[model samples]
Target: MSLNRIASVRAVLGISLTLVLATFFFSPSYSMESRDNSSSPVAGLRVEIKQTSTSPITITSTVVNDNDHTVTFLVYNSPLDTAAPSIGLLTITPDGASEPLDLPKLQIQRQWPPSPESLIQLQPGASQTADIVLKDFIASKIAGKASVALKGRWDMVWNKQKDDVTPEMIEQAQLQAEPDVFSGSFASESVEISPA
Candidate 1:
């Protein structure tokens, strides 16, 4: 590749890395249909959530890749809505409650190569974290309690199954997931975000 091309590639990758870290923080959360898997384990992936603030109710999510191989994730798309996004893809349960709070999900939409731009590849031992601020009704429910338990999940569907696929098409293959990628979910211990 020419020097210019290489530089651009590096720049893009750098931006992507930054975005992945901020995906949770900046990505606008809308009422869309995004799929969430049941609690399962894959390649030693771990997820955790914490309440960063109580004034407006802020929650942060951290995803760590413990596998030796690289894993890519589909950073979700934020719809038009820019209201208070309650939290990440985790289920919220009040302390001493049997079940978690109910929240709406977005529809699953996977474009082609262009879409994979939202995907982030995490190398072994690498982690990405982002936080969301909540001021909606959900925040009101969780306020004045002590702490609320949060559940976190990670799902992966690589873009390549059989070799022979082109270099450019690789990311798309993973983004599509197409039931080919192994999906797993795990719940995390609660963090104190609410105050009495």
Candidate 2:
């Protein structure tokens, strides 16, 4: 090819490559969907518990969603059961140390099904806060540098339908589905617990 023709072809190729790169890097939907598949989806689901009184403890959580899909939250007992008398397990370690904590059985309560009575649909970069009340679940003595570890296995379902799939079918499929048998710690934080 002539020198002018070669220069023209190189310019066109460079422009096309730049456009492709911009599309891939600047697309919000693509980036959000990519994060949805990873643990970033659960990063917003944080829980904080404190002993507000001798008999009652206050728990707060900020559940954020940075995706374009709806998510449902369900709270269940540790070891996760659909049956009644479901209880969650909370552990506390003193002075940022990883050791067994001596604690008694406690009662933790969560608002069933969550409020507003609708599926939580999060637009791009949306978030919300959830408050929980925990009662009869505070240790009698908590002092010095300590780390509180709270863990609960709650069932969650993605509500957004795939292309060409019906919501009715999804519900029916869930009815016949088996529970996932995976469990791990969700969130933990170090705190200074003062003596009351």
Candidate 3:
């Protein structure tokens, strides 16, 4: 083929390839918003639990927000009046134990129609760590390897819509949000521990 003809063919191929890629990336089925809107927020978020000590079973749980927008959640704040709209009990299973130990129950005060100001923010790509207590639930614990995991439930609202929302309005909005009750679990790697 002549030099001019060859150059024209290459340009056409390049444009075609670019258009195909752009279409794929921008398509509704392949876009990020589509996934976030369709799936549970717990699936997008991640949790990692590390057994810091063996004797008392000191666990540090880290929660990661992988969504594109910021998320508002309740932290283990007062243990009394904290709003845990989307978190559930954690499960700890020893290597050979038949029954799993659950995290100690918190005296969570039920505030119907969650307070608008009590929510904590988790920015995109951010993570927060909180110390988890297992001593009360598993007293005189046997020393051995154990696996820790979190079975969490989350009620999430878009950051943009969460601000300035009133409790009265929240109840109705909760039903309309993308992910109202997202249930999922996070499994962490086993960590060695010894009785303190």
Candidate 4:
């Protein structure tokens, strides 16, 4: 092949490769700009339980926000049924304790979203602390062995249209139109609890 033709082909190939790379780099799916900022699906949430007393136990968990946007935490006494759209009791097990802790009777409180209304926005690079006090729930007297397993399904919702909508009116309407996305198996473990 002629030198001139060879050089032209190489130049074209180089340009094509550069364009392809640029397109992938700028694509919304690959770019940070198009990422979802809402609460991520609770696939493998971390949980740690600690035993404070034999009569009563305290469960604290740190829910990490692994998304780019903020997410509100919603805690329910029951597991949410996604298919049927129903609510039921969540099963909880105390650390070193054989029996599972009943969730229906326990009272949960939080500062951000307010009780009877578990709603707290978790910003990117931020985490919220949730503390639950279990009555009649006791931790193991054994040191470092006292822990609880909290198993439950929590629903998560985020308004996607409100991303850049100004004046907030149109955004609100858009949010209403959007369905409330549900996530399940929001389980977590509490730090090991020991007699104080």
Best by TM-score: 3
TM-score (C-alpha, index-matched) for candidate 4: 0.44
Give the alpha carbon lDDT tens digit for every residue of 112-190 in model 2. Answer: 4334333344444555544334333334334454555456653444433223233454345446742221123455354
Cα lDDT of model 4 by residue, 1-196, tens digit: 9999999999999999999999998987666433432334344333333433444445445566566655554444322221111122324444556775433443344243224243445565566655554443223323334444455655444433223223243335335642344455555444445445
Candidate lDDT values, in order? 0.54, 0.46, 0.56, 0.46
lDDT, candidate 3, 38-135, per-residue tens: 75455556666665665555667677778787766543231111122123355556678888754355466656676665555668898776666555
Model 1 lDDT tens row, 1-196: 8999999999999999998878765555421213212212253667667766766676676667787666665445211112214334445667776786675554544555534455666677887776666656677667455444444333343433223233365465455743335554555576666643
Which stretches of model 4 miss by more than 4 angstroms?
1-56, 77-117, 136-146, 159-180
CA lDDT, candidate 2, residue 162: 26
The true-versus-predicted C-alpha distance at residue 32 of model 3, in Å, is 15
Mark the 10 consecutive residues where model 3 has the least summed lDDT: 77-86
Give the lDDT of residue 100 in candidate 4: 53
Candidate 1 clash figure, as a count: 12
Over 4 Å off, model 1: 1-41, 77-88, 96-98, 104-114, 146-155, 159-180
